[model samples]
Target: MTQRVPHVLVVGGGYVGLYTAYGLRRAARKGRVRVTVVDPRSAMTYQPFLSEAAAGSIEPRHVVVPLRTVLSGCDVITGRVTGLDHGRRTATITPTEGAAYDVGYDHVVLALGSVSRTLPIPGLAENAIGFHQVEEAIALGNQVIDRLDVAASQRDSTLRTAALTFVVVGAGYAGVEAFAELEDMARDATRHYPTIEPSDLRWVLVEASDRILPEVSDSLGRYALAQLERRALEVRLDTRLVSCVDGHVVLTDGTELDADTIVWTAGVRAHPDLVGTGLQLDTLGRVVCEPTLAVAGCRHAWAAGDNAAVPDLTGEDGALCSPSAQHAVRQAKVLARNILRAIDAEPLQSYRHRHVGSVASLGLHRGVAELYGVRVKGWPAWLLHRSYHMSRIPTFNRKLRVVLDWTMAMFFRREVSSLGSLQRPAEEFRRAASSTAPRAS
Candidate 1:
């Protein structure tokens, strides 16, 4: 009888998952282990470029990596792992279709990332959108352009004002970059409408925090607030959206602004399902792992990235690394090497990386960056934002495509067509059906 190969199941295909799988694949080729990866999405998305993608600075396809193309050597399954039978060393997975199946594994790595954290704000779900996925970014772009159309055509001031007003809630990197980029695009896009000018548009940013881009230096954060305010954007720090009904956004400052579009990019939390796993978790609900990145007491399982509470050895005691891509990417490499060490019976290594500062894009040739204790603003910071992220965007193909998009954007205007139809695919059919319904005879 022939002996069977030992199986290792990896859940998720995000940044942490992709890098970890890459290491495992190399190890499997040299040994008798079979690696399997499961994720609902067919690709891994480099989320940092999402703001650029939304503003038409980079092509959407360039930021995503198809897992099937890169991990051809591994058994790839496009499914969601619903349950883990740790005692039996098996996991239950549910694909887009078909019944769930239990797959046995000798080892498991849970790299499932964080989701957009939300609150019980009134009318948010119905009126606001998120900035997490490619679809959301694309849809938001389309929505922004479509609002200009309504503003240009409507004669009533009430309707016109509502159409031109847009609100963004959050001051983090995602929200600030996205708000600045979209504001620039929307203002420039109005030129094509002829009837609407940049002055007629209203952009409001509501951040409950004391300052925007808290990860950056205090001076740069203040600089960002000034830059945005100069562009006529309402930067309401220490304020929040209390309620938004239909097209009106009510703020905590007792001000009501009528806006047709709202975007929510406040922050993210660890996936709530992690709670029931019985895995050790910290106060933040992130998996509690040792410095080696292995889950406490779960001998055969390990975790890292946004879903795990990784220690900040560079900081003093009782401090943890902020949940961001900077830490997640480094953790992935360390986690992968540690897992290999465990397999080969070598001493496991600990994760140790220092903070490298942060950067934020504030639309067309404008930005803020703080690197290695040096503060930058304006065009120099913008260049750094592009240069640093360009190198970090995994895969040469994606990097090349993004570079080409930027190169083209330099000489030509950003594309301004709003494919609003993408949001409601059946709108045309519904209109036709209603029109041909015998006139309510």
Candidate 2:
């Protein structure tokens, strides 16, 4: 009888899932196991660059890692795994255009990523866009620039004000960075508008928390606040958007700000699908794993990243390594190694790491950083902010391109051409076809 190779099924191609598979491929290929990865997206996104992608500092396409190309030797399936019957050792995968099938696996890696955390705010779901994906960030940049043009040409003051006003909900890394970067880009864009001054622009950053960047040291948060405020941004602390109706933003302070652009980056919660997955998940739908990254009490299953609540072994004080990409990527590496060890019948290891610090970009050439208990600000912090993340921007192809974009941006102007067509590719064609339609009236 011929020997059979073990099948390893990985769900979700995000950082944790992709890296987990990538790390195991070299070792798992003793001609013993085959790796199969499934994800809805064709690529993995480096989420930290989302803010800069929105700011036109880096090309959007470069921020993504094509799963197929990167994992050519591995089986890549583009489908949604709707159900998992771990006991039956089978996963029900619904392909994009085919009937569902049951794929049996010897081992499974769950890396389902997080989704945008939302609240029950009026018109938020329909009116506001999220910054979780590259498409959203790039579309937002186009919208911000296009709105600047619309505001400049419109004669009506009411319409102009609404067009120029912008509201960003959340003061975390995503919200703060997006707000700062977009505001900076818009300020520069306003230079081309003959009628609009930078003062006409209204940028409101609303955080329900008492402080912005609460994860960072208090001093760094203060530095960020000072920097944003110096640019005349409305920093609404301990405040939130109660409702946004037709772009009329009502804040918790009983204040209403009119704006056309409303960005939602409040926070991220685990994907809600894990509720009935038969896996041990936390209250937030995140799979609960042991210190060794194995699904608690479940054999042959493992998890990491936003979808998994692995114990933080750093002996931290009231912390579980908040669901940040920094932790997820590191966790993925360790989880991968442990998985290989598990296959080889070796001892598993515990996952432990301290969150060193946080850094954030405040507009152009300005930032704040807290590393090793030391705080930094101004251009140096900004440089560190760029350096650290640029080094972590997935593949070398993306890293080189991002650095080039930044370097070129230093001497030349940012490319503001909006491919809004990407959002609605056939918009013009539809308009033309409709205009040519026979008039029924």
Candidate 3:
């Protein structure tokens, strides 16, 4: 008689989905299980390196892992999971250009990651862009450099000022790192532009909270704030963006400014698709999971990453793990092991690992880090920041490529060219089509 292999279907190919599939590959080879990963994108982005990619320090190609290549032993589907009926153990997946279909699974892993959480601020949806995806990071670099070109060429003061001003909302890790990296890049590129000076470029960091880098220690956050202030960046704490109508920014603190660029890195919440899954979720829409990373009251379901509200055994009372890469990567290991144990009739273990630390790169050779309760700042922290993330990025091939990128960068000046035209490839063709139309009487 032939043996049956348990099919494990994983949703969303972000950090958690990639790692979960990666962990299960070896087990699948042993004929214990069959793993399949489904996501809208065919590649998984190493989000930790996105800021550097935007700053032109690393090539954008090296920051993503092709799901099929990494998960060779497993089934990889480039599609979105629309509906998940867990009671029937079936998931409905829709491809880019086809009808939705359902697939059955013995065990399902809910690793669907978070999306940008935005409020109903005016002109936000139309004007501002989020900084979560690799494409956004790449486009941000082009947009900033392109703005410099416009500012330098424009003769009008208002036009130049608007082109040169850059506003960044949210002071968390993503917000701070993106602002710092792009600001540094702009500062470096100013030497090439005869009409533009570094002093003329306005960089503003707005945060509604009292301090920046809230994930780190108070002292470290203060240190980071001082460092940014030293660079002449307007750090407006306890302030909110009241309106950005017609590219004119009005702040609650009565500060008004005209800017061409606004990057939103405010925050992210769990994927809303979970709301349709009929699973137990917290008020925030995250799937409620036990300490062992299993969906509570679901026998064959598991959850992790930003979409899961797993109890934080190591933190304060009734605290859930923060939706950070550190927790997601670590939880993937435990979740994968618990799945295998469940299949083999072994007892499942709880996910109780404490967070090691967090490191942030504030442009080149500038950063702040808190590791194992020991705080570090400046160049050493910067080195630690690069080294730590380099080690965490999956696959030796990607790691080697990243190291080579760093090695080549040491002997060369930064590249500051803009490829913003790539975002609108058909613009010229459309203009040509419109110009050749028949004339009216």
Candidate 4:
């Protein structure tokens, strides 16, 4: 009788999906198990570097790892997992350009990850853009430069002021870094526009909370606030965006401003698709998982990362792991090993690790970091932030490329050109075709 090899279906190609499958490569090569990864995009984005990518400190392409290239040992499906029937060990996958199909699996890894968590502020849906993906980062960079160009050409002072103003909601890592870095980029870009001065630009960061960089120490947050204020950037705390209708921003504190760009990076919720998986989920809609990273009450099912509520053994009682890359990457390794152990009917180890600390870049040569209760700031923190992420971004190829980007950036001025037309590459062709079309008789 031939033995049946277990099929592991990993949903979502983010940190957990990529790392878990990469961890199982040895077993996969030996034919001990078969692995398949599914995601909307074929590449896994290193999100921590997105701010730099947006600021042109690193090339946008360098921040994402091509899933097919990295996961050559596994099957890569360019699609979305619409639903899951874990009882039958099957998942329904909807491809980018075809009918939905069912994929049978012996085990499943729910790494669906999270999406931008937005509020129902008036006109927000129409005017705001999220900063969670590389595409958004690219669009934002282009938009900033394009706005600068518009401001420089406009004769009306009010219109130019509106074009020069940029607003970023939420002061978390994503928002603060994006706010700082893009401001730096635009400030440096003013040199190219002889008509524009750095003083003409207005960068505003609004956070409902009382402080920014909540992930770091309060002292560090204060320092970041001081640094940003010193740069003449507006940091509004304990303030909410009441409305942003047609580039007109109204705040809860009765502040009104005209801003052409409004960035949303408040927070993220677990993948909404989990509701259809029929798995046990917490009130927050995250899959409930044991410390071993196995889905609770579900056989042959596993989960980790932002999608799963895994217990934090190192924290106080009833504390769940935080949905950060630090936890997600570590959880992936433990999840993979536990899956293999389950296949072998061996003891499973629990996922437990005290978080080392946090690090965030304010902009070039400015940052804040806390490691093992030791706080660091300024240039040393900036270097630490770079070195740490450089070590974490997967693959030596990507690492080398990123290093080279930084090395070159040290000697050359950052590119400030806008390629907004890339967003509508077919517009020109369509216009030309319409112009040459035969007139109706």
Best by TM-score: 4
lDDT of 3 by residue, 1-441 (tens): 998899999998998899999999999888889999999999999988888999899999999999999998999998988998988999999988789999999999999889999989998887888999999999999999999999988999999999999999999999999999999999999999998889999999999999999999999999999999999999999999888878898888999999999989999999999998889999999999999999999899999999999999999999999999999999999999999999999999999979898899888999999999999999999999999999999999999999999999999987999999989999999999999988999
lDDT of 4 by residue, 298-382 (tens): 8899999999999999999999999999999999999999999999999999999999999999999999999999999999999
Model 1 vs. true fold: TM = 0.96
Backbone atom clashes (below 3 Å) for every candidate:
0, 0, 0, 0
| Candidate 2 lDDT | 0.87
Worst 10 contiguous positions by lDDT, candidate 3: 241-250
Candidate achieving higher lDDT, 2 or 4: 4
What lDDT, from 0 to 1, does candidate 4 have?
A: 0.96
1-441, model 2: which lDDT tens digit per residue?
987777789999998988988887775556667888988888998888888888898888888999977775688889988999999889998888889998999889998889999998999988899999988999899999989888878999999999999999999999999999998889888778889999999999999988999878887898889888888899999897889988889998989878899999999988876765799887788998888889999988999889998888786654566788888889889988887778779999888888888888887899999888889998999999999999887778878988998999989988777677777889999999999999888
* Candidate 3 backbone collisions, by pair: none
Taking all chains together, each candidate's TM-score versus the true structure is 0.96, 0.96, 0.97, 0.99
Worst 10 residues of 2 by lDDT: 313-322
- Candidate 1 vs candidate 2, TM-score winner: 2
Q: If candidate 2 were superposed on the true structure by all CA atoms, what would the RMSD be?
A: 1.7
- Give the CA lDDT, 0 to 100, for residue 347 in model 3: 96
Cα-based lDDT at residue 187, candidate 1: 83
